[model samples]
Target: MPRVQDVPSIPPAGRADDGGALPPVLDVQDLKTFFPTDAGTVRAVNGVSFAVREGETLAIVGESGSGKSVTGLTIMRLLGRAGAQIAGGEIWLTRGDGNRVDLARLADADMERLRGSEIAMIFQDPMSSLNPVFPVGEQIAEPLRLHKGLSRRAARAAAVELLALVGLSDPARQVDAFPHQLSGGMRQRIMIAIALACEPRLLIADEPTTALDVTVQAQIIALLRALQARRRMAMIFVTHDLHLVGDVADRVAVMYASQVVEEGPVADVLATPAHPYTRALLACVPRQQRGEKRRRMTPIPGTMPSALAVPSGCRFHPRCAHAAARCIEAVPALEAIAPDRRARCVRWREIGP
Candidate 1:
């Protein structure tokens, strides 16, 4: 495997280099998103921070309820309907024109204008995200019409081209088809087409491969890589599967109980995880060596703690095998464990390789 380049601690605002030395397209600092429920305030995402440079893919992976999805939604400003609020933090996005703006502080009108033009998101379920009443072509053309001010006829023509761009066959005919008329993979392709219509600088793909079979999932992954490379766009790939992260992401951030426990290059983190939660996650992935007996996968011992009442000290202490007494006394800061790696565990040096 090739050595992964180190991501700068503070990314500058500009274009990317072929050697992965460019500044971050999106830099999230101490993001805290909360939802006030009837029972209590749900801290869906707490003090989560990461960055993705132009043409780079950052995968946020964890079990369900770990706040990976919420973090992505928060970045897209799509959690307003869910009654979620940004209690604190900054979401800095560098525009295509090299202007940096704090998305958290951007006005609603400004954010709305930036959504499809500067940043786009591909949701998990196409059926729910796509309008059944409208043709797929019109759905793809909506962003072009609204953001690019394209005429109806030209937008429709571009939609067909987008469908074809995403590997859909006979896009001219399929463009007129309703959401229900297509297969799951095809619908997903249509969603990708709509997202890429405006050629946004950044894309937030929230579990875009859900409900997809292995074959179709591979195809979608390849298509996304091709498109991202061609457009030189940054992407946040959110998923629960760590196995998928190795295939797609340049860097991986492991989240647990609304916080990031570990983050580093995909190769280094997977080979030598610096956090207990990250180790437990890798253990759960089933793997077998050639000419050897298959080992039984060891499931992570406990469920993730409730966000409303997260455990003190180390949030992952309850499920960590090597947890110690000090883990319950006070919370551990996400500190540097290696040259380019960070882990939220006080005993990382004692416990890690």
Candidate 2:
């Protein structure tokens, strides 16, 4: 194994040797991931496209079963080789050599080589992701040892340092404790340590802060943002917390019915949403406001349609408040509503902020 610094130098996303902006770190195009069941194929991800610039955070936000997590898993190829697989599109990642490789087409063995060294994922539910019997330190060290070729003793030492970096108390003692022995926050920090062990160029965080309390979620988000800046890494943050994306993500990709419905800067999308689904989601979050009576939460009128039987034309048409006759007959492409902003609604112009 070689030091991370020994890798070939790649230009940042927004700079070039020729005085122009460089390519994005990760470019996903028309991605589709499906899982075949006895009943039907589950279109977990459908025609999703987005990009992550170096040192930028792109949040994929949606309701449960809307396929935010599946998109992340598809990028990492974590769904494995057997039943579930990518049915279409390219996941183009910029190599350290300044060249691009399509992860979607890489061989399994070759993809495994990139898993920890070039790309890492911080999974949700540390208790389920981490080994129950093994000490958390050992679990964290496995990636370091396997990817970095560190000796057991050296890996253990590095594990303690990583724990401390993530703000775990008594790193030495914590390293030796099992996953069940730690608090939810502590376990999450351990998961972060493991994901950061190799200093991956692209980090995929799949709802890592979901289970933690408000305080802990804030801490983890802050830590992740700090780490991204310190390491200058590109990140894809998948979560259902539309409220949290503004704090950590540079951009937002709103998913619905397994497809990207909107994409734009965090402030623009959250403050003045263009899509009906995005607008409805914002209305649903619990926020603090001084009022005579608490404001009512306006949940989206209908539940998301099942992936096995997505609605015709626009996937959100059945639930859209402004659904026109054409909406149910013609699928709308994600079109530019502003500079660097896009929405999948045909009536995006008429949709108020």
Candidate 3:
């Protein structure tokens, strides 16, 4: 069996981007994650690839179970060893120096050492993510002590600082309070503080505002955007709503049936979606345009395909409105339909610009 001690550590830190106007901080290529289920193999993430550049926010937009969440976990190497594993491809992450390391190939120990210091993740549910027993301040300080090599006292002080940074009230006293003592919004703020504690280059926010009220949701999104700008960190914002994407994302990747059906600039792609799935999702978003009081939101016709028994040709063919005979006969690879834009459907052009 492969072991942590046997896996080699990546080279010394180098420049985050090799050298370009906006070089990639994370460059994923042909990533495939599979689970060995009793019923059948579950291809949770199949042949997925995307690059997040320095200081850019790339939103992975999709409905539940489209593998958007799994993709983030895979990048962080958070999947447990027993059930699922990365079957193929590379996850190239640029070091502080100009060089890059393939995270997929890194040893478990190497990944652990890098996870908090270079990459951080904020899960969907803060209440569940935080420990009821431990104080939230201690939770935030744990990573600082572990990865940043700070003393317990120093880490605690830093935790208080982080709390203030995230805009928590009375952070000095709040630092000593338990998770159960905090409100839902405050707990989410704690999660953000913990995620940003290490000042990581990449922040993977997995539906951070899903549990908040509509008003609170907007507040959290604005807070995150401000933090991202102040920190100048590259972010992978995972969510199901295009509405949320519009607020924080510079680019967007629409995932369906465990694959990215379309990708491009946020404004461009939303304005003129290339894939049927993208258009369907956009149609579902509540919009107010022109003199119309409100546009009718149309839900996508069918549910996402089962990963265990994905459709043979296009995984989305059964649910795709514009699926042609060719779409059902051959699995279309994600290819560029236009400069800086890509879609998986072979007949994406026919669907419209």
Candidate 4:
């Protein structure tokens, strides 16, 4: 965790990119979030920027505690108000009919209304997110009841439908069961059902398959893809798995220490990554091929710099194999490396893979 003072803020007025017209769902620019800690303020999301277009899956990939989940929480307006401060930035959210809203500036009351109904989220941990005391049906129905003002009976009926839609068998009977009665996968499915209660235009799925088995993970991924195609909903899929991102994401945004290191179309970014950090990450993912004697996976040399003690220049320079003296002196800007691609490395061009 880098200290607040050490992490440089991205210019509030971000680059005027000709990435053509903005996406008709979510646009975030220079977003920064900090938490007040006893040691110092921890810069969780540092000048991160990206957009999720309508009906497209934009994946944010990073290691644990890389501010991936924090970015999603910030977008959902779930950040704590008292000690957790949104230091700076603009979040432009577009509605169904090409209308745009500055989400960062919206009041709490306004944000509350937009959440669950317009923009929903499936958090990382289903067990922690679901209410232990409430029956699963009521818990799922709560969002629909509040957002749609459905009658209790109607909401309960709809909840069963949602559960069934997520592939739960005997949804009507299972609805009356409590969270403890369900398996981990079932609880995650319930969370998805609750998130989709109102058919949100955008879904932020933050590591939605964290605790599931490999088979269940594949099922959940397929489920999300199916739902996205059927509903035409924009999504921000946050996960550490590069392999998983390639499977479903249209575009990929790589994050390290609360900052975006590389971003581009998923295929191009994965096939030919420009950032050293991105390359290092990809090298670690296992590939199955005959005669492929397992080589030591190239881990990004050192551990991630603590958010509280973030390096002065490029935060990743210390771990970056291509680090130069200049990297220690000045923070690198996320400059365009090619069309529809950007990287935060001064030597990206010079240091070819």
Candidate 5:
């Protein structure tokens, strides 16, 4: 495994290296997303930062409304014009062939080209993501035909192949079926097939296995891991399940109130989370082993603060049991607590997972 120090630091925007080559695969520095509403400007993602390396799985875990989906949408440049806005920061993208592009600044036409071809997303609701009028095959084939310039016949055949690759049975028969015809798990498989159709270097899966049976969830997860391994693709797995993150994530970024509160190797963060929020989340996961008869899960106290009225300093401080006076007065920088591990808590060193 490569050490954290070995991963090169991505230079700031407009400050590319003299020999200026390509940008990082996905370099996100201090990204922020705001939504202007009747009441106030909702900061959905505030100064959140991370990177997704080629052929790695970075999992973002947070409670609902913690800006997980917003971050993913921002990276894909899919945020709509009506309410959302990228207030600051840069999203740099590097293609497989070494071409560097700034995703945040790319024109609409260029961004369209990159969406399905260079990058793809697997949305949470397979039922809603698929179009009712279009046959499953056509939905999968659309990207292939659009990006790869494949003939109609070739695209159709490729779609069948993708279906089989994602573990669907009877690819030919399933191809002609509509989204409503397939089971939840099967529809998710189809979504994976479409996302993988273009051989995108980056795949953002937003809670891909949710709303499925346990057996089906396991299968979908296994399929994702296999596809990621076979394609050597960089994947962003967004889910609230720490157990799932333990199984798949190479690295983990814990988000709270539109901010990356902590990030580091999956094992390190899971075993000994430095941030109070991280520790509280870990404690909430149910364990069935031979420990003392467990009380009910120790869910974090208090509900998530509303997006429009996020607390100052550390967003997690209000719910954090270990919060101190400093936590209320000043915000914390994402300083290194360990090699490649960082936390946005002034007293990270004192807390234990």
Candidate 6:
């Protein structure tokens, strides 16, 4: 296990196209996470790879059970308690000091030390993530106390500031309020405050606005954008909504049955998808054109395949409308479809726009 300090820095060769000369803050390469169930080993995240540069947001979009959240949790190393394991691949994380470390190989102790200060995660459910009995301020302050070694009083004061930063009204009074006292949106804001308290270099927000109303959801999205802009931190936003992707994410990776079927700039992918799964997902989102009535969403024909028994060849072939005999013969590699885009469909040239 390499110590955080001893990890060597990554060479500044592959700079991001949009983020100037900065290297990716988090580069996940071929990550595979598995869970051993009573029936079989569930490959929750299989061969997933993507990168997020500082101040950039990468959205993992897919339907329920498509491994979007699993990939995020895998990156955060939060699946151990649930009997999941990193089966293979590298999770190269660039640290604040310019050193890069493969988090997959890091010792649990070293990883723990890096969790709050270098990387943080906001779970889907704030109510379940927060300690019910503890005051929201204390919960936010806990990371500051542990990571920064701040005095208790100072940590509390900083927590109040974070609440305000996240746009929570009456931060001073809200700090003393318990989780149960807050509304769903407020609790989500508290969760965001806690995640951002340590000023982590990379933040993984897993469906941050899932439970909020439309207005509050919009508010949360705006708040996240503002916070990320101010802090210049890399973020991975996991969600099933393509609508939210356009607003929050710079790049989008579409996952299906534990694999990334398509990946590219959010605008490019949304406008003209390259993979069948990506197109299917877009079709499910209701849309309206100029001088035209709103089009009804066309639901995908089949459900996501079970991770424990994923289909051979293309995992998405079962649900893909463009799947041909060749698609079922062998698994297609994630081939580059364009300069900055990739798709895992063999017939992408023939079927893609």
**What ranges in model 3 sit over 4 Å off?**
1-19
- Which tens-of-lDDT digit does each residue in 1-353 have in candidate 2? 43223332332353322346777888888999999999989989989999898999999999889999989999999996548889999888886667677888877777787888888998789889889999999998999999889999999999999999999889998899998889998898998899999888899999999899999999999999888999999999998999889998999999999999999999999888999999889888657658655768988887889878898989999888999999988779999898789999999887667
TM-score of candidate 4 against the unseen true structure: 0.90
- Residue runs of model 4 more than 4 Å from their true location after superposition: 1-22
lDDT of 3 by residue, 109-218 (tens): 87888787788999879998899999999999999988878999999999999999999989999999999898888899999999999898899999999888989888
By TM-score, the best candidate is: 6
Between candidates 1 and 5, the one scoring higher on TM-score is 1
| C-alpha lDDT of candidate 6 relative to the true structure | 0.89
Q: What tens-digit string does per-residue lDDT give for candidate 4 at 1-353? A: 10112212232344454558665578898999899899999999999989787789999999986998889988888888646778899888776545566777777777777788888999778999999999999999998889888999999999999999999999989999999999999999999999999999999999898779989998998999998999999999999998889987999999999999999999999888999889999888656579978876666677888889998898888888899999989889999888788999999889874
Q: Clash totals for all models, in order?
A: 0, 0, 6, 7, 0, 0
Of 1 and 2, which scores higher on lDDT?
1
Q: How far out, in Å, is residue 247 in model 2?
A: 2.0
Residues 1-353, model 1: lDDT tens digits: 11112312233444333464555799898999999999899999999989898899999999889999999999999997889999999888877766677788777777888898889999888899999999999999999999988999999999999999999899999999999999999999999999999889899999999789999999999999999999999999999989899999999999999999999999999888889888888888666669878777889887878878899899999988998999999989999887678999999988847
lDDT of 5 at 212: 88
The residue pairs that clash in candidate 5, if any, are none
Query: Which residue pairs show backbone clashes in model 4?
Result: 1-306, 1-307, 1-308, 2-306, 2-307, 2-308, 3-308
The regions of model 6 sitting more than 4 angstroms off are: 1-20
lDDT of each: 0.89, 0.88, 0.86, 0.86, 0.86, 0.89
Summarize candidate 5's per-residue lDDT along 93-114 as a digit string, tens digits. 7776665666777777777888
TM-scores of the candidates in the order shown: 0.93, 0.91, 0.92, 0.90, 0.92, 0.94
